[model samples]
Target chain A: MTPPPSATRPGAAALGLAGLLGLLLTVEVLPRSGVVSADYLPPTSRIVRALAVELNDRAFWRALGDTLTGWALGLAIAVVAGVVAGVLIGSVPFLRAATASTIEFLRPIPSVALIPLAVLLFGTGLGSTLLLVVYAAFWQVLVQVLYGIQDVDPVTRDTARSYNLGTWARVRHVLWPTALPYVMTGVRLAASVALILAITAELVIGSPGLGSRIAVAQTSQAVPEMYALIMIAGLLGLLINLAARTVERRALFWHQSVRGEAVL
Target chain B: MLDVRGLRKIYGGHGREVEALRDLTFTLDPGELVCLVGPSGCGKTTLLKCVAGLLAPTSGEVLLDGSPVTGPRPGMAVVFQEYSRSLFPWMRVRDNVELPLRQKKSLGRQRRHALVEDALEAVGLTASAGAYPWQLSGGMQQRVAIARALAYEPEVLLMDEPFAAVDAQTRAGLEDLVRKLWQERGMTILFVTHDIDEAVYLGQRVLTLSASPTVVQDELKITLPHERDQLESRADARFAELRTHVYAQIRAAGTRPAPTA
Candidate 1:
């Protein structure tokens, strides 16, 4: 039973790796062979060497750390604010209705569009980057948590009430468990959104991070280094996504969606 | 003792008014088991919800121990039909049973543990104490629900068609378990079901309810012996007579026309 799927996984990985290598080879050859100018598009080998050099550079490490710090801080703030607000708003019908139009009006406004206001208010600092990141990520978590609270079974709510559970006890025992899966999903989405906004703020608002470093490299015409920084940002996004999924799966092991995967 | 005096529940207002229960009245003495049987769409559930204080009646009131019920009273527990929904899926069997006790804040840790153990033992689910509700079968899940109610040590236990979702064999086993538990605990139980045979076999006095906008049509006393086996008690002549009588009452109520303005 296990052998067939396990065997197919390696086969699938080999195919994927083969495809990735093929694309890398195409990019490697295209510029060097003069199909595209080397000045505009650096060879994969040059980019790889630049990446190796950047990995050893102290300044590169500092910039990477700064970017991650901004992202982590923004995500933490958003999660706390979103969960609290979502629970409060979702539990009360009057509050939910009152805020529905306001939430709708505010939610769809892109965080990048707030970059000008953030720059005007805080200038090019961690605050500016966090403003956009938190704004974007907060909506992700808030919407998911709202959906989660609404999804709570009426029977379960009635059971809690009939048991004479206090407000805090009911929230902890019934509401929290019911809303957790949604919170996790929100966190997963917010994690990526936070990272994207953090980078965007650094790039556009001239904040001190990897995105700013990429901007500086581009301005200095260090094409290989610029490509290397972009690649690193992509890799970081991938790692954050993987980490978020692992956390979600671990936290929601009791949930049907997670448990159903195990059965298969 | 519990008294439901002229209980009326009207959902919505004015033109959209849906009358679920109209002039429903019944009384239960301490340590007595009564079953409420009715048609499919009857207000049996609404009645139980009112008595449980989960919902307020539009008119009249439920008096528990001579106090008019305003909210969920401390000495009452309910086992709903949807056992899967009622039991917290995240908690283990023992934890689920211990929840109400923890909410009450009267029992210490050791006492709570002892009660959980006793309740699980009574339901013959001591072995599955560490398991989750979803991990158990439907019948076992319902047993966990009953165990939770038992651990509460309520003066009144209201069951709302609790065994309706399980298989026939499982339902019969659950029925017997309820009877055994009722006999042992001697707590006032109000069991609601649409199954005539189940009402006849379980209740000391079976209350037959009319169709939609329900009112108590008849109440029949069962004189069967306390010591009952599933086969012998159900096969008894008195059981058949009471079952037939309740069936006729329900049938007549179902065919009856709605009252004109």
Candidate 2:
């Protein structure tokens, strides 16, 4: 039944890599052909050279650290707060009803819109970045946690209750495991949003990260360096997403949905 | 002993109130294995939930050992119909069986371990103890669910159509397993199912429930020998007679009551 067996299908990562290389080659060619000005969109080769220089600079390393710190701290706080609050609200009908509309209203308000207030409260520092990152990521985790708790199998819940498991015991043995996969999904989503907000806060408010570095290069007319910094930010987002996925797979090792996926 | 007294339950709030169970009453003596059989939509689940203290009755009460069961008592355990929904997929079979024992505060580590091992052994699931519930077959998963209930060491075990999802062979095996466990453990069991043959095979006594608004339509005391065989016992002429009688009764009681304005 095998059709010739002469050719193998390209894996997903190889296809993605080929597409990325194609895009890079186009960028490298367009600037030289005068289709795009070299002053604004530098050739990909020039951007790579600039990136090589930036990698050796201590200040660039420090800015990368700052970005990472803001993302990590903000995500940790948001996850803890979201999980606790979600469990409390989801378990109690009254609390869920009381906060449903309020969460819906608050969740839709963009984190960037809070920049003015953040600056007024914390100035252009880590606090400003933290404020935006936490605000943006909190809703990602909280909403998922709420949905996860809601999805707890009613039969299982009744089984737990009929067994006379105490409140804390029920939460630990039954509720937590059921909600864990959803929480992992929430964390993965939150990780991406947190990275975005961290960079945005640094760029718009000058809060010291790769985004601020890109802004500095732009103002100084270092077009190639600016492009390199933007590239670094894109690379950072990719790494965070990959890491989040890996962690999610490991944490939910026993979950049916995770276990059922074919390994690539 | 467990008692369900004049239990009535009405579901829905607004103008769409639907009566599920109306004035149902039953009792189970200690060490008795009783089967509650009914047709579909006969409020069997509603009745079982009320007895297990998972759902509150509209007009009556469930009393366990002379005490009113306002909520789930520590002395009861339940095996639900949907094994896939009832067992936590993330926990291995052993952990799933052991978790409820955490509620039995008097149980020490040694006793808990022993109980879990014994329960798994009883269900012939010792080898599958390390596997997740989802990793096993459907019938095996139901066995794990039963193991969990058995491990809980409850005074009364409430099973709501426990073997309904399994194959015919698995259903027969589980029926025999239930009878064996009841005989050995000497604990009360309230098994609910829509399968009349299953009720006749597994139960010492069978109670038939009518369609909603429901009531206990009839009760039968099984006269077959206590030691049952899936083949030999079912082949007995008395078995055919008993199941046929139950089938007739269930069909007669299957109609919905006339709507009273």
Say which candidate scores most in lDDT. 1
Tens-place lDDT digits, model 2, residues B1-261: 998888999998887999999888899999999999998998999898988888988889899999999898778889999998888877888989998897788999999999999999999999988888888888889999999999888899999999989999888888888998999999999999999888999898999988788888889999899888988888999999999988888888876562342
By summed lDDT, the worst window of 10 consecutive residues in model 1 chain A runs over: A1-10
Each candidate's number of clashing pairs is 0, 0
> Candidate 1 on B160-260: residue-level lDDT in tens?
99999999999999999999999899999999999999999899999999998888889999889987778999899988888999999999989995442
Candidate 1 chain B, which ten residues in sequence have the lowest lDDT sum?
A: B252-261
Name the lDDT value of residue A177 in candidate 2: 80
What digit string (tens of lDDT, one per residue) describes model 2 on residues A88-184?
A: 9988999999999999999999999999999999999999999998999999889988998898788888888887878898788878888888899
All models, RMSD in angstroms: 2.5, 3.4
Query: Chain B alone, model 1: TM-score?
Result: 0.97
Candidate 1: Cα lDDT at A178: 99
lDDT values, one for every candidate: 0.92, 0.89
